[model samples]
Target chain A: MTGHIYIIGMGPGYKEMMTDEAYQAMKNADVIVGYTVYIDLVKEHFPDKEFFTTPMRQEVERCKACYDFAKDGKIVAFICSGDAGVYGMAAPMYELLPEYESQNITADDITVIPGVTAAISGAAQLGAPINHDFCVISLSDLLTPWETIERRLIAAIQGDFAIAIYNPSSKKRHDYLEKACQIMLDAGTDKNRACGYVENIGREGTKTVVCTLEELKNAQVNMFTTVFVGNSKSEIIQGKLVTKRGYEI
Target chain B: MTGHIYIIGMGPGYKEMMTDEAYQAMKNADVIVGYTVYIDLVKEHFPDKEFFTTPMRQEVERCKACYDFAKDGKIVAFICSGDAGVYGMAAPMYELLPEYESQNITADDITVIPGVTAAISGAAQLGAPINHDFCVISLSDLLTPWETIERRLIAAIQGDFAIAIYNPSSKKRHDYLEKACQIMLDAGTDKNRACGYVENIGREGTKTVVCTLEELKNAQVNMFTTVFVGNSKSEIIQGKLVTKRGYEI
Candidate 1:
C-alpha cells in the first residue's frame, strides 16, 4: 500500500466553490483528519471514510494522529478552509513531518491543492476592493505580537495599499480592528479611505457593508467577518465600488 | 426587453477552475464583448452569440460598444480572464457608465462578478505563497506613477508582507521588477526572502519555480509570469513551498 497525505482546501463554505481537484482528492482518501467544524462541513462527501476530528486549538495532536496512521500505509487527508497554505493546516503539518521523517516513520507523499480564499470571495461579493494594489493582514495576534500587527497596519496605511483584515475580532480580541482603524486615521486622512466588511462569505446570511475608516472603528465586526480598507485611489461610484488602477482618466 | 450587462470573470483558462456561478452567467449572456484574446478563449461556449473583439489599449472603445448594445435590452457580457473586477474590464466600464447614463442611456443594467485572480491561481500552483499576510503590487506604471509604486513597495517590505508582482515587465518596460526587487533588498534581509515565478497558471505550458530574490532576477521571466516574493516567514520546504502564519511553533 502506498502511504499518502492530501491537504485539501474546502473553500468559503459553499459546496459549489469547492474545486473539483480538491473533491477528487477527498474522495480518494481512506482516512480524513481535520477540526471538528471542517469535518462537519464535508461530512456528506465522506460518509464511509474513517473520520478523525479534533477540538479547536488541538492541531498538533491531530496532525500527529494522521502522521502515525500514514506510516501504516493509510491514505490520509487533512482538510482546511480556503487554500491550505493560507493560514491553514499545511504549515503546522509540514513542521512536524520532518520529525516523523527522521524516525523513518512516514513516506514523502504530501500534496496541497488550493481553494478560493474568503478574502477573495468576500471581495467578489462586494465590488473589487483588491483591484490595483493591496495587502492582507490578520488582526488576531495569537501567534504574532500585537506590536508586529500594529507596525503592519501603519505600513499599509503609509503605503496607500488596499487592505484585507482577517480574523478581525473574536470574543477576546475585540479591540484589534478598532486599533487598526485608529492607526490608519492617525497616519493620514480618515475620510479619504473606504472600508468594507463582509461576514459569512459564500454561506447563508452573508452580510456586507462599505464605509469609511472612521465609521469602521465603531462598526460591529466579528471573527466571521473579513474587512477591506480601500487605498486612497478607491472610491464609491454611484453605489458601485471601485478601486482605480491609475490608468483611467 | 431588459437591458443588462454581466461582467464575467472567465477564471484562469481552465474550464474546471471556473465557478458554476460564472459559467451560468456566461451561458445566459446574449451578446459578449471583450479583447480579441479573451474573446478567442471563450469562443466555443457561445458560438451563436454576437462576439465583439477589440484591439489592445482600446478598453474605453470596447466598453462603449458593450454599453451601446446593452442599451437595446440585450444580455451583454464583457469577458475577462481571472475575475472581471481585478485588472479586468469592469473598472473601466464602471468609470464610463455614468457618462452614458447622464446622456439618457438608461436601458442598460450592469453587474460585476468575481473570478479567480492570477495571484491566487499563481499561489496555488506554487504551493501557497499567500498563506499568511501578503500584498499585491503591479509593476506597470502606465496608469500609476513609479513614485507611488515605489512608496508602496517600501511599505510592503517594511511591514514584512508577502508580495505578488503583476505586469512585472513587458517589451517596453523591462526594469520594473529589477527596480522593485532592489527596493525590497534595501528594506529587508536579502538572503532570507523567497520568491516564486508562476507562468500560465491553470493553462497549458504552466511552469513554476520557487527560489530566492537573487535567483529570480537571474531567471528568465516574461509578461505571462506572476512573481511572488515571500516575506520573512516564508520558506521552501522539501521542494514544496509553504508560508507560515506565525501562529505555529
Candidate 2:
C-alpha cells in the first residue's frame, strides 16, 4: 500500500507561529524529511518519529528519498521553513514525481499545506512594510542566473513596488545585496525611502533594524536576514516602517 | 488608562488555518473589530466576546472606532482576513493614529500579528504556483491610480515574474481582469501559460479552477476571487500548476 506524502511548512521554526493544520500534519506523519536545519526545529515536537534530512544543495536527493519512503507505506511529511510553496520544497516534490511514477507514486499521493511566509512574517515585525502592492526577489544565484535576477530586481525597483528580498547574502556571495541596492538607487528611489531587515525571524536572537534606503545599503545583513524596501509612499513613524496604501491621505 | 490594540490576521477565516498567536490574541481581547464579513468568521469561535463591525467602504470609520475602543481602556483586537499587514488593517490603523493623539492613542498602543496571506494559501491548493520570484497586485482602483497599477502589471509581466492578482473584479469593474490579461499577452506572455483562480479561499464553498492565460480572460471571477498567472517557467503537470525554480531541469 502506498502511503501519502505531506508537504508542510513549519513557519519560522516556532510552534506558536504555525497553523493548526501544519501542526496536525506533522503529528500524523509516520516519518519526516527536510533540510537538516528545518528538521531540527520540529524534532522536539515529534521525538519518536523517523527523520531523514539532507544538507543544503541536496534538494533533489531529498525529494527522491521522500517519494521512496511514501512508496514503502510510510506516511511521510516533507518540511520547509516559511511557506513550502514559496521558494521552498513544494515545487520540487511535484517536479520530480514523474520519475517516481513507476514506483506507484501518483498525484493523489501528495498534499501541500501552506504556512506564513517570511515576507509576510518579517513585514509584520517591521510594522506593515507590505501594506500595498509588492514584489519578492531572492538574491541567490546558486540555481538561477544573476542576469535574470538583476532584471527582476530592476523592474521591481523601477515600478516603485515595495520589495521583499530573500536569501540576500552568503559567504560566497558577499556583494550581491550591495549590487541590488545600487540598482534601486539608480532607479530614482528616494534615498530616504524606508527599509527594514529582520534576522532570525520568529526565533531566538531575532533582531530588526529600520533605516533608509541609503542606510540599508551599508547595514549588516546575512542569509538569515529578510530585507524589506518600501515604496515611494513608505515612511518611518515612531521607529517603525509603514508603507501607506496608495491613496489620497 | 489606554489599553492595547492588536492588529491581527484571522488567516482566511478557518480555525485550523490560524496560528496559535492569532487565536490567543482574539481570546485575550476585550472586544473584536473588523469588517462585517471577517468578524462573522470568528464570531462562533468566541461567542461570549463583544464584536464591532462596519460595512464595506467604511474603513476610515472602522479604524477610528478601534482606536476609540482601545483608548477607553479596552483591549481591542482589530481583525482582518489574511495577514493584517498585507493590504489589510495594519496600515490604516497607523495612518489614523495621528488624528487620535488627543484620545491618548500612540504607536506603542498597537501590535501587528502575521497570518498566512491569500497568495500563499491559494498557491498551496493550486500546487505551488509561487515557487520562485513573484509579485502581487490588487486590481481594485478605489484608492491607487489605475496608471500606477497598470505600470506595475506590465513590469511584472515583462520581468517574467509570477503574479497574484487580488480583488480582480467588483460589480462596477467587470472588464478590468480582461484588460489586465491583455497587458500580459501584449508583453509576450504565452497564451498557453498556466493560470489559476480560487473563490472564497479557506472558507466554505471554496472553488478553484485552473486554465490557460487565454481562457482566464473570460473565466468567471468576482471580488473574492484570487487569480494567479504563471511566469515563463510555469507549467501544468498532472492537472496542477507548477512553477519550476530557475534552475537547469
Best by TM-score: 2
Weakest 10 consecutive residues of candidate 1 chain B by summed lDDT: B102-111
Q: After superposition, how far is residue B246 of candidate 1 from its true place, in Å?
A: 2.2
Q: Write the per-residue lDDT of candidate 1 for residues A149-174, one digit (tens) a residue.
A: 88899899889888889999999988
Which pairs clash in model 1?
A86-B131, A247-B143, B3-B73
In the order shown, what is each candidate's alpha-carbon RMSD?
Answer: 2.8, 1.4
Candidate 2 — which residues are off by over 4 angstroms?
Answer: A247-249, B102-104, B247-249
Q: Where does model 1 exceed 4 Å of error?
A: A1-3, A45-50, A65-77, A102-108, B45-50, B100-109
Query: What residue pairs are clashing in model 2?
Result: none
> Which tens-of-lDDT digit does each residue in B49-144 have in candidate 2?
999999998887888888888878999999999999889888877777778777767788888889989999999888889999999999999988
Provide DockQ values for all models, in the order shown.
0.49, 0.73
Residue A54 local lDDT, model 1? 88
Model 2: how far residue B190 lies from native, Å: 1.5
TM-score list, all predictions: 0.91, 0.97
